[model samples]
Target: MSLHVTNTLSGEREPFEPHDPDSVLLYYCGLTVYDPAHLGHARAWVHVDVMHRWLEHLGYDVRHVENFTDVNEKIVAEIGEKGDSEASIAREMIGATLQDMRSLNLKRAEVYPRVSEHVPEIIDLIERLIDRGYAYESEGSVYFDVTAFEEYGKLSNQRLDEIESQGDPDERSEKRHPADFALWKAGEAHPEEGESGGQTWESPWSEGRPGWHVECSAMSMTHLDESIDVHVGGQDLVFPHHENEIAQSEAATGEEFAKYWLHVRLLETGGEKMSSSLGNYFYVEDVVDAVGTDVVRMFLLSTAYNSRQAYGEDALEEATERWERLERAYERATAAIDGPDAATKVEDAELRETIEDAREAFVEGMNDDFNTREALAALLSIATAINRHLDAREAFDYRGLRRAVETLEELGGDVLGFSFGRADDADGRVELAGDLVDLLLEVREREREAGNYDRADALRDDLEALGVTVEDDAEGTSYRL
Candidate 1:
């Protein structure tokens, strides 16, 4: 839990070794401006936002850069003879994306560089690759010779022999090897071939657009430094997209591209990844409207960033119930602290101890690879203690309750990026929570009967961490809220 991260490059939970002791250079791969952002995108945004907050909380000059791929063919597809230019389409979709980001309460990055704005830098970078003998020109375009970059597949753990064509089939004849990818694609020489031939830029190679992978490298290097502390994106990109990024970036700079590569796992429903092409994704704006931004954020944070999260009716419902529980506790504590029953003479050491322990446990969980699951459990423990104090005691410890509220706001609200105290009632609380507890109790009973006291105790401890208190009496096991 000492500031560790599960780095994709190393495949280990190692200490977060910063490239710079006083700062973190972070880049999150942003959306291509072809469609509105979705819950899948929201998952990454929430996690990256948490990372940014945690780093800034640690007192670092976090220079975060997120990119918008404004000049992709997908943008052209969306235009589709509507008399709308690719640029206009991109602008509209980018607006959609920013709307989602704002609604999700994501912190603004230091810069949101777009591919269109960085074309000069991208052209210069392609020139560097060619000069370094790592790229070549074909007809009027340029392609990175993957075979020349000795470390071509290091990031993806792929070998040149195992790799297939990195570009379109037509490019195979131009590419020396199947794995070579385009650095710049030439516009159609014949204007009759494509309507957007006029959109191409006048480059040293020819009038053309930057390839998908090179756009990120150029934008990142232009906005951030040549080398960065962390480069994060969804896991689905690790194969060809990220692999090509490392190849082209390191080849150009002759230095490491990123110190740690963090890839957030996919969000799925019914075992299929949430994808626009598949028509199986939820638009961010719709979800936020339906459930509210706070519940969506809470639901996303309930699972850690590195784990695959299921998105469905049940998950959303669970998140709603959990948020209500947390919010009700926070509301109760605040009310009790100022109520007439509050007394300066009242002292609750047990409650104070619980608050302090929860605070520490939250930090531990966050440090352990940003494990929000564990951190939420810790905060829920504090919630349970607050409820017990309010439900049982006539007088409240003002100072202790204040500290507890601050801890919740600081750790839960700030770090986890969840908005609490929305004042929702317990009507939405999980109706089947009792049945689930009974199931757990049955499992614990069997474990105890099998003489596995350690396992049974572990189960009890887990239940306690989640605000459930299990009691074994003379007749049977009973749990209290």
Candidate 2:
């Protein structure tokens, strides 16, 4: 069966067809570098990583470009908190973001274009829009004329008239219409006059920064092509962000922006979508440390990317048990290859058929809209068969066991991005993750002894929310995760 993906543009589950049959151009709208990546960000990252892995597994040379919006007011807001200047703060947070990505064992994109570094490309794209009569400059700021693009709201499926104001409040008066988004927001004519306290580049409009929507368009077009195979992002960006991208990009190049638009749904906890605005986000680093990267991958990939996945202690514990089962089964299969029964060279037809079945199911699951949950189920079935064979140790087939081993590593590790051989740091770094709990308890203990009861209570409450229970005893504060 051919691979099928639910395209956001056509609102249909269509067959996978890259613009280039031999290669795939994938662009994921990455995080704005204001802080460390949260679970929401990690969810998108893992799914995109899986997509990359699956395409490469299918022999498609994937040129994936995931961008970082370093030129945002949010990065500037972190001046004193993260660094002294805009560049310094971006550098600090970008480093943390890259570290977080690495810790998750994500496949690095071909290029991670930063908005601050792509100013020239952004300006060139915006200039095209202006010259084509699709954008206008007002008060030194250039805005995309939403009305000019007849299909302005095509991506998001909202009429131009019904949409609310697009950019910053100061931009409302300068726009031809409230729905018109900024291609270039007017900034200080010089980098020194930063009331917004951000780095600026010299452009025809002003020494201003590129708007959020235009950054992706310029970066994608420059790195890949004006018309690409796939564009991936979070579900939340469907509205003004992606809609604006289609308008500005097509207006500039007069070509289709992206053929397939893939949006990953939100990760929720306590029935609330994990969001920064809602104050319900958990950092990717903290979670990875709590459970190893393998467990983290297992937890995220438990549900399909387009479906909502809940986050909680119960879910993670279940994923932990599942990973342990798969890992143990893998070890048993590997060890059996050179076991006491190795000389037997017995080929169990049943085991061989089971391996073939698992491979077929894995491929089918992957083809069916990248259904990782189903794919993982197929892998777990292999573990079950492997366990059954090893447990009934009366003349087991070493050849069959070898096939099972290869199947597990190939399907489980290669496509789904699981780490079956974690002997390196599974013992060291994962055990060290426990120290975080102890450190937090130490701080809470200080708060309690220092007579800051409210602060102590707040810490305990925070710990409880994170699935860690804090207990106070005659000895001291003890916690269980």
Top candidate, metric TM-score: 2
Please write out the lDDT profile of model 1 over residues 1-481, one tens digit for every residue. 5699988887888898788899999999999877889999999999999999988877888999999998877677665553367788787677668768978878899989888888899999999999999999998879899889988788888789999787779888888888889899897322234555325688997888888999999988888889999999999999899999999999999999999999999999879999988999999989988988879988999999999799999999999998888888898998987788878888899899999999888889889988889989999999999998888888888888888899888988877777766424432453467778889899999999999999999999999777676777799788754
Q: Rate the local accuracy (lDDT) of all candidates.
A: 0.86, 0.86
Name model 2 segments beyond 4 Å from true: 188-196, 343-345, 425-481
Considering only N, C-alpha and C atoms within 3 Å, which residue pairs clash in candidate 2?
none
Supply the global lDDT for candidate 2: 0.86
Per-residue alpha-carbon lDDT of model 2 for 1-481, expressed as tens digits?
A: 8889999998999999998899999999998887778998999999999999999998999999999898887777666666777888787677778878888889989999999889999988888888999999998889889888899788888787789887779788898898888888776422234433788888887878788899999999989999999999999999978888888988888899999999999999889889877788999989988888999999999999999899999999999999999999998888878777654666677777888898999899999989999999988988999988878766778778888888888888888888887656666764675788888888888998899999989989998777565768798677655
Clash number for each model:
0, 0
Worst 10 residues of 1 by lDDT: 422-431
Give residue 218's lDDT in candidate 2 (0 to 100). 91
TM-score of 2: 0.87
Q: For every candidate structure, what is the RMSD over all alpha carbons to the true structure, in angstroms?
A: 17.8, 8.4
